[model samples]
Structure formats: C-alpha cells, structure tokens
Target: MTDPQNWAAPGANQPGAPYPPQGTPPPGAPQNPGYQNPGYQQPGSPYPGGQYPGAQYPGAQYPGAPGGPGTPPGPGAVAPKPGVIPLRPLGVGEILDGAIAYIRANPVATLGLAAIVVTITQLVEVPLGIFALGQLAGLTAAPGDPADPTAIAGVLVGSVAGSAVGALVSFVAITVLSGMLIAVLSQAVLGHKMSIGAAWAAVRSRIPGLVGLTLLIALLLVLVAGVGVVPLVVLAVMQANAAVVVLVGVLFVLLSWAVALFLGVSWALAAPAYVLEGVGVTAAMRRSFQLVRKQWWRVFGISLLGGIIAVIIGAILSLPFSFAADPMSDPIAGVSIVGLLITSVGTIVATTVTAPFSAGITGLLYFDQRIRREGLDIELARTAQQG
Candidate 1:
C-alpha cells in the first residue's frame, strides 16, 4: 500500500496540471457537456458509473457497499470527499457494532477469553486479600518500640518488600489478562481467529513494548508526585502564601496529569495496531495519534459512556455490601462473608462483561483510522479474498 502522507495530491495523481480544488475537476479538464456528478447515486446501490463494489463517495459509501449483513445506510456510506477513507467518529453504536462482530466471529474464543480474565482476577484478588490480612497481622505483632532504629529498619524493609511484591504480582496479572482480552477482541471484531496458543504467542512477542509503556507511565507519575509535593512542602515551611502556592501547584499537577493521560491512551489505542499490523509500539502510537487527531472528543465520549455504565453497574452490585455494614462494631465490618463473596463475584462479572466492549472500541477505532489514513479497506478486502 502507498503512504497517504507521501502520496501527492490529486495534481500529482494527474500529471502536468494544477491540483483541482479537492473535489472539483481540474481547469480545462475534459468537461463532458452532459456529465453529472458520479457520486450522486441513490442509497444502497452502485454509483451511476457502476464503480467498484465497495467504492465510497466523499460524504459516504454508496448504499450497499458490501459491509456485514444488515448494516444501516449511514454506516455503509462514506462521510464525504473522494481519495480519502471515511473516518467514522467513535460512538456507542460503533462500539456495540464492533463487539457484536467479535462475538459473532469467534464465539468459542470469546468465552475462553472471559474465563481467562475472570480467573486471573480471582487468582489475584484471593491472594491479595490474604496478603493484606498478613500485613495487618504483622503490624499488630507485639507493637515494637517506635524509636528503636533496628526495629524501624526491619519494619520499613518488610513493608517495602511486601508492597513491591504485591505491586509486581498485580501488574503482571493485569497486563497479561488485558493483553489476552485485547487479542481476543481484535480477532472477534476483525472476523478472524487464531488458536489460543497462537494468540498468546502473538502477545508475548510484544510484551517488552507493553511492559515498557506501563513502567514508563508509572515512573512518570512518581516523578510528578515527588516534584510537586517536595516544592509545596518547602514553600509551606518557608511561610509562603498557602493559597497562591497551592493554586500554582494545582495547575502544574493538572498539566502533568493531562500529559500522562494522553500518553497512556495513545499507547493503549495502538496495542492492536502493533499486534496485528506488525508495527513497533512507537510507530503504532504515532499512527493511533494521527487517527484520533480529529476525533479525540468522540473517543473520549465513548470512553466516558463506558465508564459511566461500568460505575452504575458496579454501584448497584456494591449496594448490598454497603448495607451490610456493622455500624455497631468499633471496626464496623462492611459485609458478611457471604456478602463479600457475592460482591466479589459481581465485580468479576462486571469486569468480564465490560472487557469486550472496551477492547472492541479500540480495535474498531484502529480499523477506522487505518482505513481513513492508509486505504485499509482495499488491503482488507484483498487480504480477505486471498485468505
């Protein structure tokens, strides 16, 4: 495929003449006296000139553009403008459409994916619960002297080691679980599949890039905190005006958070691109940023909607536990063992339910951007036909 970025405008496509205004025919071009716009065809049918089966016009694809069965006229058609792939802005319907594609294309694999994810959650959650209990046990063990340097060093070492171990365990578990979910959903949405082992193998090859991005973001947050808090502490100690200092500090904090969010989302959005397109993480991220450049809000809105739905579902599931609180007790245990079990199960189910929708959006967004920026429709059709 040719690089759209490098491809000369229509003028270059047509030799020895100025490029026409994007859609207009060039000056003194063969003006057929009786010609009408080839793009003005009726919905769901071929263009008047009987163009390629999937040819799209500037505004949209011609009706019946050979998308999946039962796609509506709006999805089937292009947005507007020729020589450009239509970038369908992300929407709830688009997210659902991608999810449905995934399920329909790979039912067996999808179930396996759900089981894998939920199982990992259980594995981490159960062990982590016990670890927390152990930490509590340690802290209550014979309340040692606070001023003893030896005792303090031992406690500090133990605490840091425990926290580090827990963090490493959860990080690996989540990354592996999320990677599997993403690979499965990408296959599902693309109407393709590989064996479970093959899918795992594919993700393994990209582990370094994924792990690097994860650690990079983690370090960035730590640095931001250290920088911001240390200065604020110094300022407070020096008797500076607290309100002004805090406002300035808050602005920097917000800026840092925004940069981190953009970097994190861009990295995540490119995961499928890297795995499927054989692109490096950096290149994939560059590609994703380009794809989302014009439609950040649409993607953000879809994310917001998904988050809201997850929160609402989570809140409902959590209500029983909330009501189970033992207000009379000093510690006030929040739930019975049975209630805890139910809540854990509910949380796992919610995560499992929402995983595909989230993964599917990124996969679909990848496809949309690829199509628009790289003429991916042609390559996809060709790849499919060859297969």
Candidate 2:
C-alpha cells in the first residue's frame, strides 16, 4: 500500500481542484474571536473581577500576617522564648514549672529576697522562742503543788502571745518579700532581668499596701476563728453539757474554716495585684476577686497544692531538728538553747527556699488567669518584643 502521507483525496490530486481555499471562513460563521490564542488578554484575566483569593485588595491586609495593619496574628504565631513562662494559657504543670523556672532564672532576686526576709523572721522568732521557754520554766509547778490553773493559764497566754507575735512579724516580712519577688517575676516574664535593689525599688512603694492587705486578711481569719470558738468558750464557762458544747463547736469550726479557706483563695492574688497594679488594698482585693471569679476552684486547688508542698518540704527539713529538740516534751526540760537555735535554722532554711516558690506561683497564676480571661498574652508578647 502507498504510504498514508503520500496518498491524496481523489479530487485534490487534480491541481487545486475545488479544494477549500486556504484560510477561508465557513459560511455564516463569526470571525475568530481569538479566544484560544495564548497571548490573548481578557478583562480581569489574571484575577477574578471582584477579589483575589487570600488578598486584601486596596488597603486590606493578609489574614494572620505578623505586624500587618488590620491583620490579627495566627494562633501560637507569636510564641517567644521562655522568659518566665510560655506566654499562653497554662496547664497546672506549666504553672508549677514556671514557678520553678522563675527561681532558677533569677536566683539572686528571688532567693536573695527570700533569704533576707526569712532571716529577719528568724531574728524575731528566736527571741520570742527564748522568752517563751523562760515563761514555761516558771509555769512548771513544784512536785507537791496542786495543778495551778492560774499559772497554767499564764503559760498558755504567754505561748499564744509569743506565737501571735512571731506570726505577725513573719507575715510582714513575707509580705514585703513576696511583693519584691512579684516585681522581679513580672519583669522576668517580660524578658527583663531585675537586680535585687531594682526589685525592691519597684515594689517599695507598694509595701505599705501589701502590709495593709495582709493585715486585713489576718484580721478576717482571726474573726472567723473567734466566731467559731467564742460560743464554745461561753458554753464551757457556763457549765453547759460537755457533749453539746463540743458538737456545736466542732460544727461551727468546720464551717468557719471552710469559709475562711474559700475567702483565702479568693484573695490570694491580692498581693500581686497590689504590687503590680499599684492599687490600694481594697482595690487589690476587688481585683483579685474579679480575676478569680469564674476560676475559684482552680485558684483554690493551685493555692492548696502550693501550700501543701511548702508544708511538706518544711516538715521534712525540720524533722531532724524536731527529733533533736523533742518539742513534744516539757519545753523547760527537753528543749535547749542550742536545740532551739537549730530548729530556727531549719525553719529559716525552709522558709528561704519555699517562700519565693510560693510567691512566684501566685504571681504566675495571676498572669495565667489574666491571659485566659483577657488576651493578656498579646500585651505580654508585645512587651517582650519591645524589651
């Protein structure tokens, strides 16, 4: 057979025999619109007439672009280095870790402030401890003497007074220290390092406010205890039925204790607010209550956890000293000056270490709550970047 290319139509084999004229348009057909040509351009051919996908046509910004006007950042797009915490809503573990990190990152500020306050607390406590021991020595009745209720009462009063004084002093000291550490932690969260002097200077003006808040809390607790105990005391003195008085007292104490604990957690962030926001005690209390409103249980749990941890560690540190001092025995007989001093040393060490951690946890928890309730992480991120 002939090759296909060499073959021709029967009519076309004759020269130009009625073949279709080159490039002739078919009858009644419109001229070619040139739509199929590669170089042809149409209206809005590059983009749709209305808008382009993912484009902000005139002055609009691309969604989620950093630092773009009218654009919000994408989720987790602004994460910076861990200064004190990852600037986001935090888990319980993260909060705890952040507290530890605060200590590690600014030991001179956190630990040094703790040590100074704890040392002052120890100084106040040691003298009281000695005075209490002396008072106990006098309260010991001679072997033949009947139990002297008056002398016994004197000893009880002395012990209680000594404890109250020591507690008050420690409260003031810790309040001051916590305010300073909070200032430090706030700066740390913004990726700034603060010297001890700087931290103190930042918080110095707020110390009086912190003290006032501390006193208010203490007074509330005392009132709660008094309300729970006064009825029982009255009934006992009036020779009421012992079982009745005990039962009523137990119920009252339990209820009051629960209320006190709830109130305590509600106001736990007051110090941070007072120091950081430069607010008054009443305003700080209100601010803390507002922050903790919907997250009361969470705040309570974290505060209780921190308190338990501090107590456990303090007990562990004091265990050896407790054994040496034998405080359970007669204060006059078993306790020695050296043993008392050693016990104080244990307390000082424990307080020095745990105080900062507890304070830091509170401050960070405040920040975490703010980040969740308000978009504080954005402000913090901006602050971090600026710094």
Candidate 3:
C-alpha cells in the first residue's frame, strides 16, 4: 500500500491495454477475481449441480493491501494478500483454498443465502415428487383385462410435465440466489462486505439473463445428445445390421461428444459473465468462450476438480441426514410423506454447504482466468480504490 500514487494499472501506457489508465493500482483490491456462483447442487451431474451450481462454481472474497500489487509477486512469490486469495495468477491449491476461505469470510451472504434457497428448493420438490409418483402409482387397467395404453400414457405425460415444472421452479430460484451470491463475492474480493438484501439488490436486474443462459446451455447439450442417439435409435427400431449400427453409433457418439465438450468447456464461465458483465445470454456465452478458449484444459480441470470435491464433501455431510431419512424415505415401498420430508432435509443440509463452495471455486477460477488473460487485477484494483 506504500506510494499508491505512482503505481499504474499494468500495461496502462501500453498501446493495447484493455482500458486506458493514468494512475497506478487501486488502494486495496485482489485486483479482480470471483466469477459466477451456480446456486444448484444436484446429483448424477457435475455442473449447475455437478456444473458450478452443483458440480463447480468459482472462488471468493476478502481484501488486499492499499499499495500497488507489490512488486508483482514473481512465480510463487506470494502476491499481495489483501483478500482471501493472492492477487497474481492463482494456483490449484489457492483456488480450492480460497473457496473455503470465502465461505467463512462471508457466511451471511454465502452460507445464509444458500441455506434459504436450498430449504425452499427442497420443500418445493417434496410436493412435486409426491404428486408425480402418486400419478404413476394410481394408474390401473381400464375396464378391459389388459392395461389401458391411454391411461398409462396419461400418467407418463403428467409425470413428465410435473417434473419439468419442478425443474423450472428450482432452476429459477437457485439461479437467482447464485447470482446474488456472485454479486456478494464480487465485492468481497475487494475487501468489501454485503448483506443478504444488498446482494439481492445488486443482481436483481440480471435474473432473466441468468435463467436464459442456463436454458441455452441445457438446450445445446440436449441437441448434442440427440445428434448422437437419434440415428442409433432409428436403426434399432428398423432392425438394421448390427455391424453398421455399431459403426454409426461409435462415429456419431465421438463427433457429438467432441462438439459438446468444446462448447461446455468454452462456455464454462458464461454464468459468471452474465452476472458480472451484464451481457445477454449469447454475449455471455461468447465472452466465456473467449476467456476460456486459450486455457480450455485448465478451466475444464479446475471445474472438474471442484465438482469432485463438492460431491465428496456433500456426500459426507449428507450421509447422517440420509440415514435418518432412510426409514421414512423408502418410496419403493410407498410415497411416505415423512420419508420425503426427511430426505428433503438431508438435501437441504448437504446442498446448503456444497453449493456455495462449488460456486466459489468456479467463480475464483473465473477471476484467475481474467487475471491471467486480461490483467483484470488492474481494473479490480482501480474499482477497489474508488469504492
């Protein structure tokens, strides 16, 4: 924090700096860090749930020193420690550690908000689950001895419709909450703090775009799956030759998978972009792609690692609750309301903890990417100084 007046945003005078600057680094910023924080923490998938929501999210807050980024910490030289993380490009351990630190640093905004959202999401799921399962169990054969196709179809349709509605509800609720959390992290990184109401207010206008971004990524994935499976399904229905079927299936699978992976990794930061950059869904996607395209593997690896940790931690934390719910949660035996409610409680406890951590890791990853690729530390420092 010494001699603040002379320090200039790195590359400020360079012809190609992202922004023009006349002064040195801001007073006390990590520089910039913290990305989107996916609010969901589901199972069987790494992202949104397993993605950043459940799978992975980015990192978090705290502040740094007032002086410039201090001699630009050389390789592992320990950059300015104004916040939860170092200002320079982050390492694998730093990213993970920062996530945990952030939760502790901003419990009310991070943990408190997460608990509220997960509680609501779980409570909502209980009724929807019972209704859907009940519809399936209620179907009986028509007047005829044989089962009625129409009745069966009706039940299936109803179940799908119900599930879709529930998903939409949970998605919107968690996505908004996650966005609010990111807003919290954005300030926290600058050594700032925010209340739950303040966090909500910061992100209120971006709700629509956040929801849209989630849906578009989902739609793209579904389309990729269809491309890989539709023809295989058709061949099976037609009783096509086994050899030809296998070959086509393998080729299609590989092609679709490649495309999906490219897009998925490239757009890993889209949620963060939407929240932080105030961009549309498509624009956010492009922003993430540009940010991630160069270090695709690194981004993918960090996200993968974050998702893995969240799953392991969530499983450990949730087990006791799951065991408690086991007696009442046996749906195969019957839709026991007690069991369903108990199960929901377990989910709430587990996700409440893991969701923010997941989001924080990915959000931090986003900050790391920007710092490395765009020298965002300078901009973040400036922002901090102004604030």
Candidate 4:
C-alpha cells in the first residue's frame, strides 16, 4: 500500500503560483477564502467541500494538509481533525501523540478505568502475595528438621496459586481495558467526549467476546508452547542423555518463542477489532488476521515499540517504590505488609498510566489499518460531519 504521506497533492507545487504564505490570504485572492494552504489557493470559497481549517474551529488543520488512508483521495489532502488525530494515515509519532492526547482529553474516563481495574486486581493479588510470602518465610525459618511436608505443600501451593491468579487477573484486565479504551477512542476520533460510565456502557455488551478473545489467545500460546514442552517431557521419560535433553529443550524453547511471537503480533488487533467492529471472538480474530495480512512486520514493529514504551514508563514509575519497599517479586526479600502496600501504590500508578496508553496505541493501530485497507478515514470524516 502507498504511504498516504507520499500521495500527490495537487497545486501543492504548481508553477507561477508562488505561495501567499500561510496565515495570510494570497496577494490577489479575496479575504473571504481566508487563508488557503501555503502554496495553493482554492478556486472559490475555501474548504470547498469537506473538513478544513475554514470549516473547523480556529487553529485547526489547514486545508490541503494531507489525505487520509484510502479512497476518493482528494485535495485538501488532510480531510480534518475532528479528534485526537487527523483523519489520515497516521505516523508513529502521531499514533504515540494521539494515545497521550486521548488520555489528556478524557483523563477521568481513561485513568479512572485503569485505576479501578488495578484496584480489583490488587485486592486479589496483595492477599495472595502476603500468604505466599508467609509460606516462604516458614520454609526459610529453622524448623530444626527437614521442612514439614505440610509446610512445603503450603509454600508450593501458595506460590503456584498466586502466580496463576496474577496472570489471570492481568489477562482479564488487559482485555477489558483494551475493549473499553477502543470504545473511548472511537468516540474521541469523532470529537466526542466520554465519561467512565459511557466508556463502560459502550463496551459492556462486548465484554464476553473480549474475555473470550483473551482466553483464546492464551490457549493458543499454551498450545504453541506445548509443542516444545511435549518433546522435553518425552525425552525425560525415556531417560535421554542429559546433553541431548538440554539441547532439545533449548531448541524447542526458541522455536516455541518464535511461533508465539508470530501469532501474538498477528492477532494483536483482535481486541480493537472486537470492540470497534462489534464482532464475535472468532470473527474478530479473523478480522485481525486479515488486517495484518501482508503487513506482519509493520504491525509487529508498532506493537513492540508501544510495549517497550509502556514497559519503560512502568519501570520508571515503579522504580522508586521498589527501592523503598522490598521488591514483591523477590520472595527472598521477605514481603512486608508495608512493602506490599507501598508497592501496590506504585503498581497502581504505573498501570494506570501505562495500560491506557498501550491500549490506546493498539486502538489507533486498528484505525490506521482500517484507514489504509478500507478507507475508514472517509467514513470517519463523514461521521464527524454528521455529528
């Protein structure tokens, strides 16, 4: 697909028509046109047909800024900016900027959603964490004998249960937040504001599908991992040579990771697809696969960058807390209730800021893909006008 930025803009560089210089009408053109593009002039009244600086609020995009993703690609190159981003194929910077822009635009809705979810997750996690840490403390203490079987069992059970619960909570939280955030973005693109209640309501009906999508993705990952794990299990059962077992395990680990990465990137848009297109889980998965077709690396690169940014932000925000409190992940550090509470504060802060931002990037990527493949920008532009 052609980059929208490279699309030819007519009269942008015409001969004998030196620019009137922006923010000013041309030397000969009438004031009614009131500031056409820098190098070009509209034949009649400005913003002749669609979204333009002439039609929008003061300080909005100039007409002829650039065209959107696809279809009926016309002059005024940029259709308009009804919301966080222009109705056009987005740049990496624009996508990142728009994600932050939405958060600022509806702080209560975006940040509040994240905070509530994090609270729910912590309500479950903190107790389990404390229990697990207590078990570790018991095991580490001098019982003067080999550890009691029951005590060992408790440590194993508590650690396993805590890990499972945390993973499950994170999966559900990400899915739910991502779906709702996409709903928020859809409206934001049309220049509408949303309350937390509105954001929840928009995605309420799609909740089941969103959860199912997450589960499906998780199951696929496990299945792919099993491809590696099964061989190791078999090799061990047969009393395979240690060297062979290690080599096989290493190769399978790499293979599984590669396969998982491939599938993860391909399906990264499924949550956005489910919310925005109002599709079922299977349909959304298919839609994502379709959108990512022929663009695997592009989608992967964008997602990787977004994930990296979120990780960096979380680490920075949580680092001070880590130093102040015993790190929760380190059972050896001995989880103090105080430490847990302090860590919880940092976790909430980081997740609140990062979750919505990451989700926002995915949502915009979905829009970007739609704009490129299906002329979604045109549809969005029309919707903005009607609204």
Per-candidate TM vs. native?
0.64, 0.72, 0.76, 0.76
lDDT of 3 by residue, 1-387 (tens): 122112322222222212212222233423433322221122433432122311111222212422232222222223344457765567899899988887889999898999999888777778888886666555532334566789778877887887788788888887887787776666666666678887776677777878888888988987986698877888989999999889998888888988898888898888876777656678778878878977999998999999999999899987887777677643443546666677778788888888888888778887787766555554554455445
Q: What lDDT does each candidate get?
A: 0.50, 0.69, 0.67, 0.71
Which portions of model 1 show Cα errors greater than 4 Å? 1-92, 104-107, 134-164, 221-234, 314-343
* Cα lDDT of model 4 by residue, 1-387, tens digit: 222212211111222111112234322435543433222222242534332333122332233344322123345444478889987777789999999999999888799989998888888888888877777776777757686889788778779988898988877887788777777776777677777786777678778878988898989988897788888889999999999999998899889989998888889988877666555677778878988888899889888899999999999999999888865444554658789888988999999999999988998898787665554554455446555
Over 4 Å off, model 3: 1-77, 133-154, 233-239, 329-335, 385-387
Q: Residue-wise lDDT of candidate 2 within 1-387, one digit each (tens)?
A: 122112111122222111121122223434443211011111333634312123122222222336673333444344444377876667788788888888899988888778887888899899988888877676564666677898779878988999999988988888888888887777777666778877776767667777988899879977876688887888899999999999988988888888887788888888877766655678778878888999999998988898888888888877887787675556444576677888888887788789888987899888877666544554455445544
The order of the candidates by lDDT, greatest first, is 4, 2, 3, 1
Error of 4 at 178 (Å): 1.7
Weakest ten-residue segment in model 4 by summed lDDT: 10-19
What lDDT does candidate 3 reach at residue 64? 45
lDDT head-to-head 2 vs 3, winner: 2
Q: What would you estimate as the lDDT of candidate 3?
A: 0.67
